[model samples]
Target: MIGKWLDIGPTTQIEPGSARTLPVFGGEEIAVFHTVRGEFYALVNKCPHKAGPLSQGIIHGDSVTCPLHNWRISLRTGEALGEDKGCTPTIPLKIDGGRIFLLREAVVA
Candidate 1:
């Protein structure tokens, strides 16, 4: 399914500065985010620091702060910011006709 897109849902389902979760049957749970600036991003729901559910974390700009440890993660790169030293996995996403899609392979692999 290379180059294929998996339609998650419409953009408006997730409010600005918030996120929604998509569960993969046998894979990792994903967090789809809509930034206050109207940008969209997707990452593995887990935080790099303590595996906190990022979908439950607070979004600010292009970063998300882990709710458990308050570690900030870069939404664009999935890197733990500041004194942190870990990285989460980011999923490739695109917005088309107000719908959100994730790369098919990336979502399952």
Candidate 2:
């Protein structure tokens, strides 16, 4: 399904090397990450392995380590890294004039 861009907030709202979880429609949440390299990524907040909170995980490079079971997931592609199986959904994001935007559609697994 086609998704519309929904403004989230200013890019400054999230500090570099940190993440924020925003509650979306259908009671699901999206994890928005600001990398130390000044890049932004969005992914489904829950880990595919054990529904761990990715937002609370440690951010290193472009991947986040799942808080529940140490599952590492890529922020760029939402794919589980190495030796791991399954993946979470990714949310397309955009930045305009220092503001962040997210697709309004529900994330698919």
Task: Give the number of colliding residue pairs in candidate 1.
Answer: 0
* lDDT agreement with native, every candidate: 0.94, 0.90
Which runs of model 1 end up more than 4 angstroms from their true locations?
1-3
* Model 2 superposed RMSD (Cα): 2.7
State the weakest 10-residue window (summed lDDT) of model 2: 100-109
Residue pairs in candidate 2 whose N, alpha carbon or C atoms collide under 3 angstroms: none
lDDT score for candidate 1 against the true structure: 0.94
User: What is the per-residue lDDT of model 2 for residues 18-41, given as tens digits with 9 covering 90 to 100?
Assistant: 999888767898999999999999
RMSD of each: 1.6, 2.7
TM-score for each prediction? 0.94, 0.92
